[model samples]
Target: MVSLAAALASLAVGKASAEDWAGADAETGQIADIAGLVRLAARFPDSGSVALRLLNAQLAAGEMTAALQKIVVLYSRGYRLSAASEERLLDMADADQAAWLGSLFGRERQSIEASTVFATIPANALLVESLAQDPQSGALYATSVVSHDLFVSVGGGEWRALGLRDAAALTGIVRDPRNGMIWVSSGDPGLGSEPLPGFRGLIGYNPAKGAIVRRIAAPEGSNPSDLAIAPDGTLYVSDGLAGVIYRAAPGAESLEVAVPVGTFRSPQGLAVVRGGKRLYVCDYRYGLAWVDVPSGKVNRLSGPGLQYLDGIDGLWLHGDALIAVQNGNRPMRIVRLVLSSDGKSIESARVLEQANPAWTEPLGGTLVGDQLLYIGNGQWNRFGEGGAPDPDNPPGPTQIRALPLGK
Candidate 1:
């Protein structure tokens, strides 16, 4: 009799799950034929074996491109890439195949100027630790902090890395429609010696020019992790240290909506749904909850799955369902959890995308229109040697990629 753990381990490494099976067949929106199964197998490849079955097919068909695509595809659909697995892939890959896989690594001197993935587009941002979308233009604003960039591509323009002034790595990004400015809560400077801990919080850039517009710090010493701008332009900031949420109306600096946010312990993400009718906060420490913008009423929306995780890092409202991001241990992961039909609690969770130790750090995500933009930070990588950069650690692939929204 195989032990239960053994059985479960075997299952994970053997064949693709029904959920992954269904995702690979996006055309029919259902899993049916062997071709779809083959794709799923190649992409996800069960739990234990690294889906060697799929890799063999890739090698046989000479679909090296397709094979690489499949690995990334599997990840977009919530598959975490482990370090051991990367080592295995590298070891076995032939010359051409090895080159393909090796190409994904980042360089210290050379930066990924641009990257585009035609894989399935998920309505949820996979690893997006923080997301900012425009309610009016339907345009999206996402920051790939690990990559040190801010991007906008609604009307079509390759994902532009809106460079920041003082070596900025944005966490929370949003648009100022009124002023036509894109702002992000900036981190410390990267170029100088011992850069300040958290330089001016609000860092804005000009979309048209890709230049830094200005940098503004929270008036009363507020260090924010995520930010949401209201309909009237009143910005709501989730203060990571204080475990509190504050509002800054337009030009004013003093915090306005200083209501006591319950147990914001380790809480970071926030999204405004229905044009500021309410604000959703991922208390992370507690779970996902929201504050009624008008009445200031707070409620806990945590249920069985999604928000209950320890690294319940970020949250976003995708139409009816409230999407969540869980960056637990090791194989950092991403998920597009669905709310129960009642619009109250989490019912079912589907792994939209995942980040393992090698490719990138799984932080959190932002849910865009059928698009999930995830953020990664190697600064705190758990599996390998992770920590803040030394004098010149040669920025570890500070780049972000947009996964195709699954059909």
Candidate 2:
């Protein structure tokens, strides 16, 4: 059996492919096929895709008992298997096993409460990935991933397109509190209406002037996906495609690599803590970790009783806890991770919202005083490759929700 420590150490090696099977274990000298899958499942416990692969592998190896055990594990995690897959499992199980497995269906659906729509963006905006709020005027700003535009709304009014439109696939929007300049990350994930030959970087817009004041180009071939502003006004950006973190000192013309490549696999959401001394980074595949801002040293955050932290898309620091938008999870939930006093581990995780009926896939959000205003329906599936609308999946107005976080 692979130990948890060993599995985490090899996390940076990346996720296993579905076709990966037939290998020898270098550590235990055992057949590594099933063991490798087991290690992946352990690392990504909340990933329904990984769990299904493990279950299929067990069944293929004629390990019926192991397959049944995997099913129980899936049930505990609230993973919903497809009807066809469930039928196959029942066909292969004994009467007693079938009876037990039948009761696990529909348990993954959770009730949604305490969340309401704050604003709605029209369908023409396409896929909006992130939002920001003007601290002074209470205006909301949203960035689009498909339409390649930035939009703004005031006083819960309709969203209006802003002037900036040169970037390809705008993402992650945040406002610098000191200057009130709204910053947004732009990248090309091959989801744009027009082909932007070579444009991927960060754009700083002066909300007052309605114009882009500063622009910083990301590294060549890097897709800058998210942004986080520290308490001191320093900007931190995550390159999701390149697995790198970039930092820019206030008013700096260029970006410096804070955490170099190979440290994370697909880093998404970023949150700063300890007065910007430590940055909590959420790696979509390997879960969450802390990066020392000055030295760039990384320490994975883990402890007993912590829920799986993988698949988090948006992370925000709320007092002593982190609110995460987990769009990649099976059911796609919002969770609050209360940090330990030392900020090294999670003491507990509370679900603020889950299985939200209004969400297609929750993306990025901003913390407003004691509440979180997030994009509820992302509408990513409505668009196909190269930013064409999928006829089968018609687009709908985007919904942003306001979830109150009391002190």
Question: How does each model score on TM-score?
Answer: 0.54, 0.86
lDDT of 1 by residue, 1-407 (tens): 22323322332221112221111112322433447546543433222122333544675676665556555434433334466766677786677666655544221221221224322222122222355556555555666444455655564444444455564446777677677677677653232344344354677676566677666666454555577677787777776655667777677645554555334454577777657777777654334565666787665554442212334566667766665556542244455556655444456665555543333554444455576665545334321122233434333333334543443
Task: Write the residue-wise lDDT of candidate 2 on 297-391 in tens digits.
Answer: 77767533335577789999999898999887767888888887878777777888888777778888899999999988888788886878899
Model 1 per-residue lDDT at 74: 41
lDDT for predicted candidate 2 compared with the true structure: 0.77
Error of 1 at 343 (Å): 3.8
Q: List the residue pairs that clash in candidate 2.
A: none
**CA shift of 362, model 2, Å:** 1.5
The C-alpha stretches of model 2 lying farther than 4 A from their native spots are 1-32, 40-52, 106-108, 192-195
